[model samples]
Target: MKVVEQIKAPILDEMETFEQKFSNSMSSKVALLNRITHYIVNRKGKQMRPMFVFLVAKMLSDNEKANERTFRGASVIELIHTATLVHDDVVDDSNMRRGFFSVNALWKNKIAVLVGDYLLSKGLLLSIDNEDFDLLKIISVAVREMSEGELLQIEKARKLDISEAVYYDIIRQKTATLIAACCSLGAASVQPNSVHVEKMRKFGELIGMAFQIKDDLFDYGETAIGKPTGIDIKEQKMTLPLIYALNTATDKDKDWMINSVKNHNKNKLRVKQVIQKVKDLGGLEYAEKKMLTFKMEAIDILQQYPNSDYKSALELMVNYVIDRKK
Candidate 1:
């Protein structure tokens, strides 16, 4: 079945409400924070974080109470995500995000940092108001892991010596950890049991890993989206596919590829050369196959649960996560 057909409309409707709730919380700030918040709102994102929260909650409990609680929780998750993006742009010195002028780019690094801090404070305050200690703990842990992951990636970036295992570990920590937390928090909202929570968390982790690897793959793979391919190679970060390709490359090819990444200037011409080299080395193809494996692993986990619209939707989301055009 087509993945979109498998995602029930009811879940999407609920997610819309979650988006509104999350956006409303960012309101009432001063001009700069308000503008940055609105700028973020204007740019489109899949709202995937909240979707995961709502989907997991629906699987365990489909009642009105559960839905409401999960929506609130999901909004919190999205807010945290937004806060991170604001900070990430500043750190990356990025000029754009989601195809819009980034806060840092539009305003300045100092203002962007302040805006990020405000968003984080708001998220924390909301979490506290909800009085869910577990939720607070999850956010705290996720932030810690995210910071560590970013630092680790920065430290290891551009080094061709990076292995596939280390590549997976970095993505898992930086991208997957928070996604896993969303599912875990959603399940906990209803069941609050370890088994179900852990199951959903694991499912999210695997899917999140695939989701990001696929994103990285697009930097080399065929992309319909306007995302410039091989940006990471230009940035010198050795992602999973590159790591795998390097491991399997011919000795001369490996040496040349390594030199290409390390020695190339940030100019467009050199970046294109490295991209062509990656394509020749089959890095993009290897990443696609690996992404498919993780997507299937996520689907396999849903097999443990009974057949339901929620389970089906979760399965559909797994496919959507990797196959998304943008």
Candidate 2:
């Protein structure tokens, strides 16, 4: 079986149940809304966010069975995350997601934006109705950070000058915050008010950091990682590897790279040369090392908990974040 399947071994039942809960939570009175939601649900990507919620809850739960709040937490995260993705598609003018036509592609942008707002409201209501304020707070913060991260990236993208510190800040807010919420929500659902909640939050944040770095590495590919090489440079998204290369380059080389990324980004040959230059300047190696560091730090947090399938699955998750090919 694939590593993702293996990671789900311990939480298979919870995941199965969470599916029904998640679908139910999205139910709407309007037929059009329901139809759009059905499409979203059917085309969902790997349910990694909910997996984090269930795995952490079960790992921390005494009976290994998740409670109502855990299910609610998973549903809320999914709803909010889906809303963000829908809005993102509209913002990016993207027509495809996970190989399926996005909501805006099929239904149009105006409807898609409304659908996103509907999902956001649904997520907020699910938490408020259940009085899961703690869980709601976590998701709220993630949404805020994700928006801030996107804006921060855009603000920096124009000038094409992003320090390593700014790069970390962007990924942490854009990607890491959501994963952190998943782990923390899991812990809060089971072991509320304990240090475990904060611990799991940190664990997820580290894994998220590693995950984004791995994603950045894909743009400077050694494999078929779905996206085309140097896409980040083409878009002027200052990812880690390129940033590292820029940081280490001589003045002349730095100008050349900046010119390549800024002015000649549309030129395939220049982009290819930029990719090769990043690799030659040790950018890829530096990024891989940092990714592994975050992965190891995440694994260290799991050491405090006793042995369990849930814990083992979480460990597998941390490794998978860094090791995933795409």
TM-score per candidate, chains pooled: 0.89, 0.98
- What tens-digit string does per-residue lDDT give for candidate 1 at 199-251? 88888899989989878877764578644567787778877767876788789
The list of candidate 1 runs beyond 4 A from truth reads 1-8, 29-32, 225-228, 265-273
Candidate 2: which pairs clash? none
Runs of candidate 2 exceeding 4 Å displacement: 224-228
Query: Judged by TM-score, which candidate is best?
Result: 2
lDDT value, candidate 2, whole model = 0.92
lDDT per residue (tens digit) for residues 251-315 in model 2: 99999999999999999999999999998999999999999999999999999999998899898
Best by lDDT: 2
lDDT of each: 0.79, 0.92
lDDT of 1 at 22: 79
